[model samples]
Target: MSITERLSRGFVIFDGGLGTMLHSRGLSAGVLPETWNITHPEIVTEVHREYVRSGAEVVSANTFGANRLKYGAKAGEFCLENIIRAGICCAKAAVGDTGALVALDVGPLGKVVGWPGGVGFEEAVGYFSETIRIGAEAGADFVLVETMNDIYELKAAVLAAKEACDLPVVATVVFDASGRMMSGSNPAAVVALLEGLGVAALGMNCSLGPEQMKNILPEMQKYASVPVVVQPNAGMPHLEDRKTVYDVSPAEYATHMREMARAGARGLGGCCGTTPEYIRKLVGALEGITPRPITEKKLTMISSATHALVIGEQPLLVGERINPTGKKWIKEALLAGEYSEIAEEGALQADAGADILDVNAGLPGIDEAEALKTIITELQMITKLPLQIDTSDPAAMEAALRVCCGVPLINSVSGKTESLSAILPLAKKYGGVLVGLTLDDDGIPTDVAGRLRVAEKIISEAQKHGIDPKNIVIDPLAMSVCADPDAALTTLKTVATLSASGKRTLLGISNVSFGLPMRDSLNASFFTMALFAGLSVAIVNPNSAELQKAYRAYLALSGLDENFSEYIDFAARRAAGGEAAS
Candidate 1:
């Protein structure tokens, strides 16, 4: 089955904490060679059977720390082939004809690559390729690259695994307490980098406790286009009797599993300190729950405060504040024919991180079309982030769109006949991104499905006008949360449905938190959640530090942070500049 199909069925349960299980069977912390799987087949088989009996759908082989480097120079002498083969055979025996998956577990190379330790990317790839070859040859179903921190290192491992065999690969990175990789890689950069590398699934494992994972889940789900797996610790390890103890009971741990399911996680498993009972409880808790489907919505790239809406990637934020729609000063400037102020505002937003700037000169006292032309010209001289021509007047939109440099985005076309008739043609003519609102000539639809129908109609009309589906961005129209508790969810559901259609989705995120207390919290949470529903762009107030932080966090968790170097740089700068006050 496809990854989405697997997720939709129910949460896939991976077996719990292997190291702890090994220790429980009288293996000391630094003793008992794990490579003994070749010499002591019966013990390994018994452990695999225990996990199977405890209800694990997948049990990892006992070959985690068995890499050649870890097993020392005697690795060849001890027979690496025999060790790996025996482990897989043992796991297969435990699984029987029930057909549970077996993953060839690959851990880090222990030494850092490049400047820090001199291990080059090719060398690392070669090392991991060896493991992949061994695992595949031993009949492993998939390769699990877990607990990785460096993006380059992870990339090496992924490349090696894919090159070695036809088996699927799942790559996971471990985050530090600060929600970034040890090297400062965040989840967003991780997802972006790994997804581009073609991993079957990407996720976090062996990080902080469930509560911490819960806080980061919204961010994780937002940027992930593939299945997301999370295997958090039972809780932070505590020193007890000279060994680590996790205070969370199996029941308590299962509570977090349910939360993960609700947060859109498709794969659930436990890390350090968990046992088979934990997996059993997790399975029980997630029994009837279904993973959320990707939304099938259309979105248009527009001017936004941060980045330009990338249909399949980052959401382009088009800053709406630069327009003279309702502001008296803006209107006065337009009537007075002052272009510098418009240029200055556009420049400021671009510098502040706007991916695109929305230009509107629709003042009651001015010639809208003429003013729009002048504003667009001036702004073009100051920035290159792209522009979204914003005007209800079709003539003005056409005029500005013609002069705007780069791939311009028409602010909108909609379900309304006039809008569809007018803006759709301009979007098609200019070959630019188109925004579709889920509303008709009558008014906004209150129900999600109605809004979705309107969105579909708008998409059909845009396609009829010769616009590509990828260029269309669908806005579900966020409503006030206080006005109706269900309003936000309704918009989210619409976005989710739109996403599944393989079209881009956008949302004016700040609208959802209107009139609500702690609006930032509400807005940030909603923005993150919308991303999970496949929202590709957000029209948000980029000036808010809280919002920016949340966006950065989301980007990092999504694995878009590259090697996490950006997040690390940001953190280091924050600390050096006293932005992070202790």
Candidate 2:
């Protein structure tokens, strides 16, 4: 059966290490193993046949390092098209009449992903798009973008596959012994980003063994709504005879694979130091166990490249100072292109316990798109806090989303026709926690029911574009009470109504106290009221002393502070003239 056909049935086993087998046959170290596809097609075919005979249902071709970067068409005798075509042909010949599937193994482009001095986002996308396009033309059933060490590179590859061809793209990243990517993505973070990018399955491979990889399985399972793919090394590597070797035996490795399968792995395989025997042992070991049904976590989440922040974990604080809405310094900084000022503001908010940073660079007579991109990139350099891409322009929103290192927050989409038309596609294409303001072309709703209807309309509209409603955080916007005596009551009622219906809610605390004296005191009470009403996120000035004190107090009183640690830490910071004192 095809891999997709078997996905619903049980675990679909993948072939073990190809480089290991190639080296055993005297393909020397550091000489591109991919060239062996054209040079010694028979050797490549034999290795694939061995895996198929050993019961591997899906065999990745020998095209792991076959990108245009390493083998550019210019001076190379080995072109990417020729190499990948030959590689897939070998795997295809082995799978003939065997009911197995072939996957073109697309590895990293050998550069930093989405970094300043590294490969740019579109350039990386172009490279992977060309390779995946060629792979689909060459008759591969799926694209396996494997051994990723950076989340941005993984996003680039998966986005390329989606834009390039219709093939199912599966991705796996390399996690260090600490259960984080070299770029610092934890398992939860990886799950959030890949699921956002819409990969068929996401996983870990290459760096650690089945035992070490096993320790991270629960975290992946906790957040993963799709199949969790794992291809751990046979064991940890050690130097022997001046060469690297793995320590675990095939039987020992299979034992661990079986344990991982039971714990929520829907796809299992081996990385380095495994031959066909490992697959054979693994296949036999997984005979009677049923695969766990993939869970629908429905979490409202966003992430940096390093960590995931789930909403409803004691109301997230999104720092509101990065935007140029009312901040003259930010406006000046954006116009002057002073990234240092932006970074400093981001750092300060982070120090004051902001869970996410709201980034906006929209100003007249400037390219909002370009400024948003620049500010988002610069802020990430200073902190790993997930960013909220705040802009009224659709172009600015897209530009910021394109370069964001991890899953971010799309600051808004309201009930208006134009807003929904432009923004939902971005949110759907680039995964994020979308904030939907409860307003439309009819303007701000005066009644709680009208606002609730708008939120429902947004949830419905976002769903039409295939956005999970859980990913939509409803903002029953806080209007000034000076304008309407019952405005705060309407917003609070809408927040509580949405919260009761299992919808995540957000509120801008400052909006309620606008045009009022002692606004900080009023904002703190509003914030506490929103918390009691089950707010999920608050866009506020994290540097405000009264607001900080109120938030810490709420957490401590509600038992969300875990033995009052967050509260005690806030008190300690206040004593030290920190944010609470400022």
TM-score of each: 0.54, 0.97
Q: Single out the weakest 10-residue window by summed lDDT for candidate 2.
A: 573-582
Shift of residue 559 alpha carbon in model 2, Å: 1.2
Determine which window of 10 residues in candidate 1 has minimal summed lDDT: 299-308
User: In model 1, which runs have C-alpha deviations exceeding 4 angstroms?
Assistant: 1-5, 75-77, 294-582
lDDT of 1 by residue, 1-582 (tens): 433345456677888888787777767666644555766667777777777777776778877766667654664646666667777888888778765788888888887753345576567778888878988998888888998876556767887887788887888888876777765566665664555445778888886777788777776677666788889899988898888899788999899879888888888888899988888898889877777754423333332111233456664566666666546788778878998897888887876566667777877867888888778767754565667677789998876754443356667788999889988876654446777888998799999889988988987887787665767778889999899999998999998888888877778788888887898888888888887788877776666656666776777888878887756765675578678823
Per-residue lDDT of 397-514 in model 2, one digit per residue for the tens?
Answer: 8888988988998889999999999999999888998999999999988999999999999999999999989999999999999888898999999999999999999998999988
lDDT of 2 at 248: 94
RMSD of candidates 1 onward, in order = 16.4, 1.8
- State candidate 2's TM-score: 0.97
